[model samples]
Target: MTEEDWIAHDPDPVTAAELAALDPGERAARFAKPLTFGTAGLRGPVRGGPDSMNLAIVVRATWAVSRVLTERGLGGSTVVVGRDARHGSVPFAIAAAEVFAAQGFSVITWDHPVPTPVVAFAVRHTGAAAGVQITASHNPRTDNGYKVYFDGGLQIISPTDREIEAAITTAPPADQIPRRPVHPADDTLIDAYVTRAAMVRRGDHGNPRVALTALHGVGGELAMRTLRTAGFGDVHTVASQFAPDPDFPTVAFPNPEEPGAADALLQLADEIGADIAIALDPDADRCAVGIPTPDGWRMLSGDETGWLLGDYILSTLDATDAATSVVANSVVSSTLLGKIAADYGARHVVTLTGFKWLARADAELTGFRLVYAYEEAIGHCVDPAAVRDKDGISAAVLACDLVAHSGAQGISITDALDRLALRHGVHTTAALSRRVADAVEAAAMMDRLRADPPAELAGFPVGATVDGDAVFLTGGDQQTTVRVVVRPSGTEPKVKCYTEVGLAVGADLAKIRERAAAVQQQLLATAQSW
Candidate 1:
């Protein structure tokens, strides 16, 4: 069927009886097709229709994954399972584990919810064949997800993602599948995670006045424990969101990067004069920071935070003479690490925008200690020695430590960013998205751009075009980018565009920013026409 036809079809295509049984919105939501697993895994609303993520879908995915693993001679292998505090996540984790155990795989399940990255860590540390995490990362509360990690606790990337998805698309009969009871193993991995996270702390402060929120998800208790263990004191918790609530009662979007998502924490920060406000996603894998700025409680952009943490990690490494290398996702703002690498005379590399790529690269490469790897999405991987995956808990501790170091030097994160921009060339990035009619349309649009791309944008000559399903980098160094990358929404009917603009390394920050802003307008216009 054509792209137009797919979008025009009724989402539910259900009978009158089923339609009558649900609210209008509910019916519509149910009708829409939930996404299947991708390279990054499955994510969508928990209560949506046949396609949405729910107990049934989770089980189906688990069964499918198990079947594929069994066929690959991995049936008896141990599988590590973890979950965040998203609504229905624990049950989903248990469901997945039960399915895996019933399929005859040994299961090591966490007793309490933990960050997504910890699941990846456990997989590698425990020598499990694969891992599964119940989380939607930074998605809205209505959403929950299932992310799979293969051997080495790395995200299942291309070719492999396709292989696993093909197996899922052709699932065996549900009746033939057996549902097993999930038994939780004695998981000491969480403690190991905490110990490594604590290593991110630098100075001793007895304890810092910290304000934390689970955001009505799973981060609050574990985060507080880690902070306290790291010698941070006076941890103030947000009253309403202190507990895990799948509904995410207090926030519109569960992600901390969105505007006003940190409003409550910022207000509390003002009242208590806390050192910093740390917010985790529903899954506690991605983190956001809200620190006091001269302009008010200004939340640092993910790029800004990544830059700060990268600088701190590099600086600490220099003092300790630790053998380390730096890595980042292709989409992140490179305001620090490149120069830092130049200073240390180490290697720096960029991968496609996912931990799957990062972790796999880490295992494949050698002589390069990966001190840190982060993307602008607030996903950070610290302690490459411990967990070769993004660990929000570690990131939070490192953020606290970075703040402490800055405090001792009488500087703020904003000032740190300014200094980095001054040292490296100022870099700015923006992402814009359009809700397409369906996947087919999105694909067709991308194909068209690939075939006959624009020659220029807003009078800036198109330097080049890098077209991948998940990445598109346009323009060259020294020339401000008029770039547009197109990627289908892993969980929704949207095509995301990542636009970036960078001036020469020595260009004036303010003037380059203005020019980049103007270029971005033209880039968006070009993209809309596509």
Candidate 2:
């Protein structure tokens, strides 16, 4: 079929008109390649093309999901759907529900925008066969996406993702796809999530002055309510970014990890003398934290937050039975968590990037219970048993509880970090990423790195190289450690390199960190050149 055929079948007039206005060259570019669905699901700019995220794409994707479910003997199963406040998200979500309903499946949908984790929780809470969340996560406002969760409320992996894509290829067109009214989602699920989130707190730690921001997405109201319910009544939200604005006017990008993205929240923290600050991504599935330091206020790296939370949870567990308690981080995350777990006699597991793997650490292990899991990209799964996904609201509440407890003991978050360093080695981490024109270039880069690995990084001799979808270069002798993992991002068109350096606990941490930063820069420069 040609572009005209696609436009003819499009249900949304706005997208159809946009496609009709494009020139011949532009039209070919738009339809030349079909969007590929992977572990992250379908995501791209909101445009009228097979390559973009439009009504037709969503309808077809939903139809494919329905077919896949039926083929697996779940034809009449319940499917839950939810959306963020992104452009075209509501209509796209509704379209998905309509497709599901048309396929003889029961559909449940949220009336208002909610966090992605809520939808994931609803899938498990209601025993639905599948769930879909319309969001772009921390991507730019111009982008939108579809994320799928299976029966266990975990994102689909491996054969499932591939099977859905195959079904999409043979699905009917948008106009031919059937539609039906969607049922209202159960509000009880939301209440249940809030209650479960509040329970994550260990004790009645007094409320600490906290500043929070939603980054102009849909997490504002829910986050505030959850905090207040968790005994944190002194929460202050960034006024400019509290509301769900699709354009995200306050920041160049909605991701809290981006430079200056959390400026407004930091400023608010200083103004209110907040003991801690938190920023949630657009979908509220990831969290970024900031704390007051002696010189000023600074945001904690994802690794730092992961270490703190992992340590706190492990410390509270019954050490006598640490073998049954497990903590996990990604392959690229800091190795300090392993040391902390060992100190507390708990087990530690490492997996590939993404919570889809981290959340299932327990299931993969023989007889261990996953107490906590985190990745270095500000994604934390504090209560995997309840949500089984990264939940910013729950993480924020837990962070606040930690802060309140630390304050009561006359120590700050920084003080806790110092103590951690004193016990374990000072571990530092850095990341380097490069955007490429296309996937071909990314593949070539990875292939080249694996075939001819770097002999050395900075002044350290390269110890070993392991190859996979990502390539790992290890450095240092038997005493210290340095590592760099280079790979293409699964969800975006970029190649990312992760680097880490470990120093003995007694070394001057400041100077060691500075040297590590220099080494990271050198490694990044070499990788970029390749």
Candidate 3:
């Protein structure tokens, strides 16, 4: 169909007006290519055309999803559909539910907005054949998405993703697809998930004063309830961000990892003298942490959170469980997790970036359970068996426990980090990222970096370089291991340069960390030029 035809049949008036406002060339440009799935699902700006997020695309995509599942003999099975409060999310989700219902499948969904984890959890809880969640997570305000989870409550991967993409490309047009209005199910499953999240932490360490923020998304209500249920009574939420607001007015970006994203939370934490602060992304799939320091308040790098949580969770593991369990992190994350896994006798696997890969660690390793998995981008799957994806609510509950336990010992989390450093070497990590106009620019940038990499970086000679979808540079300087990986983000329009400085722990732990930070900055600067 032509662009004009798409506009004529477009279901949403907003997108229809958007298409009518654009010039013929610009409007046609959007139709030059169809929407494609990245990582697990289709995410793009919500606008007119098949290349973006709209009711028509959502309908077609759901039709494709239905087709793929039916081919696997899952016809007439259940499909769980959900949405966040982003622009166009509600209608997109409704359109998807219509497709599933029209296809004669049992549809399970919620009347209200829910976090990304709930959809993932409910899929398993309901014994559904597939799940669909309309969320863009922490992307900019104008963006939206359609995410899919399969039978095992795991994000779709590899051949399955490709199959869905193929079906989406060849599926019927939106107007031709029939949809039925369906009633949403009760919240029993969501309630069950919150209760389960509360149980991820162990023994009752007294509830220390906690500060939290949902970054103006759907996680606020659920996160607060889960933490309180986990015995963390002294919780304070940033009131301005406690409610679900699609615009995310308080911060320049909704992501907790972005600079200044947690500014309001830090101020609140400092004012309340809170023991720890937690920031959950818009969809609550990723969790970022902050703690008090002698130098005032500061957010811990995702790596720091990973190390602390990894240590705490592993410490709770029994000998039998630890022996047969697996831990995995993205290759770009700090290598400290691998060493920690070794100390605990747990298998560690370094998968490609994205939680989609991290979620499949146990499946890849036969006869092993995946106890923990994390990515340095503020994502943690502490309860993989329950959620099968990064769950900010569970991570927040467990982080509170970590702080509470440390307080009971009459020490701060910083002291816990010092102990970790003393056992494992000091691992300092930093990133240098470059934004691009589109994937084409990102590809050109990667090619340029790979064609002429520096002979040395931050005083470490280039000992070896591994080239593929990403480039890995490894070398050493004065017993410190220098590691760097440059790759295009699977979910965004940018190329990320992840750098780490590994140095031996010394008598002056602070002094050792200072050296590592300086080296990491130098490495980041070097990577910036690439």
Candidate 4:
């Protein structure tokens, strides 16, 4: 629709006035392109335009989802809607719930802002046809999003995403779209989630001092309560980041994986003499862990945490079930999990880069059950049966459990990691991401890499180049192995390179890591020059 038409039909008077105040050029830019619906769902800055996330867009998306559900013979089915503490999240969620209600679907709306995983769990707990979460996860304060989950509480993928996009294109204007009063949200769902989260604890172990930070998101209270209820009573949360703040006052970026994001939590851990520190992303769907080393406090990379958690979970399973047991990680994640799985006589599957794939790994494989799944981006699915998504809260609980178990046996998490390195080798991973001016530039960079691939990276000879959604390069011989995968960010105008180097397990882990870090820097520079 034209800018004038959008202004005329916008349901929110405030947004309409904002658009009316804009100059012609600004208005044109706002409507220059429509927001594309992809596997991650709709995410962008919150503003008054077809390309931005606003009340009108939420209404249209909800209408499209209602149509798709009805077309799939799910008319009048239950649809659960939830939101986080970000700006405009509550209104957008209410608007979505109203749209579903107007379409003759039973809508369940949260009474207050909650974590994204709560909505995912509620979808299955209530047997809803689909679920919608109004959040941007760890995006900046100015951003918002709409995430959709299908019947099994899994995010929509493939043809489902495309079908919803088509429906959105044909949706009516905001003024013509109808809305109805939604039913009061059932608060019991949160209780049910707490109950299930508590069940993730396997046994009683030593009580290790812990520190946590929610990064100014909505997951703090729930996460802390769940941990205490699960028998980990000694826990302290970073005061500055405990409350839900849309502005994320303490950090420039709310993501735990970002530089300096977990600094506050680390300092807090040290001050309290805590055994470990845990940081959860804004929406609590991803987790980042930190430990105290002789050098000082250090945050563990996503791969390191993944391997630790993957191995810990694998060790708890029975040998008789190993044949049917499975552990999965993304293709870009470290391959150490696969080796760990193999050692236990279990299978490991490498999927595309996203929890959407990892969450459904069990269903895709016949006769095998997914015991654990993780991605390189601090996402872990510790209990897929309860919540079929990357749940930071549950993962945090499991990490605490591991810390307690290790402490009881006179070993710290650091000691356990060192032992794992001795058994599985030192697998160092790093990511190089560059923001481009536009999608054209990102695609051009990808094309350039594919057409003239690097002959060698660091000092290792580049052996093979494989192409898919991304381009991957493999190097080194049987003694040592290195891998580089380059691809464009699915949600942003950027190209990302993931590199991993493997060295034999031995006593010189620090030296091996230093060498690997130097090689990673060289590989990143080489990719950038290309």
Tell me, by TM-score, which candidate is best: 3
lDDT of each candidate versus the true structure = 0.72, 0.88, 0.90, 0.88
Model 4, 118-168: lDDT tens digits are 888999888999999999998878999999999579998978889999998
Q: Quick one: ranking by TM-score, best first?
A: 3, 4, 2, 1
lDDT of 2: 0.88
* Model 2 ranges with Cα > 4 A deviation: 507-511, 524-528
List residue ranges in candidate 3 displaced over 4 A: none
Clashes of 3: 0
List the candidate 1 regions with Cα displacement exceeding 4 Å.
Answer: 1-35, 47-50, 110-112, 169-171, 205-208, 319-324, 332-336, 444-448, 451-454, 470-473, 476-484, 504-530
Candidate that beats the other on lDDT, 2 or 4, i.e. the better one: 2
Query: Arrange candidates by lDDT, highest first: which order?
Result: 3, 2, 4, 1
Task: Please give the clash total of every predicted structure, in order.
Answer: 8, 0, 0, 0
After best superposition, candidate 2 residue 461: deviation in angstroms?
A: 1.0
Evaluate model 1: give its TM-score.
0.85
The candidate scoring highest on lDDT is: 3
Pairs in clash, predicted candidate 1:
11-31, 12-31, 30-49, 34-51, 87-246, 207-232, 207-233, 208-233
Clashing pairs in 2: none
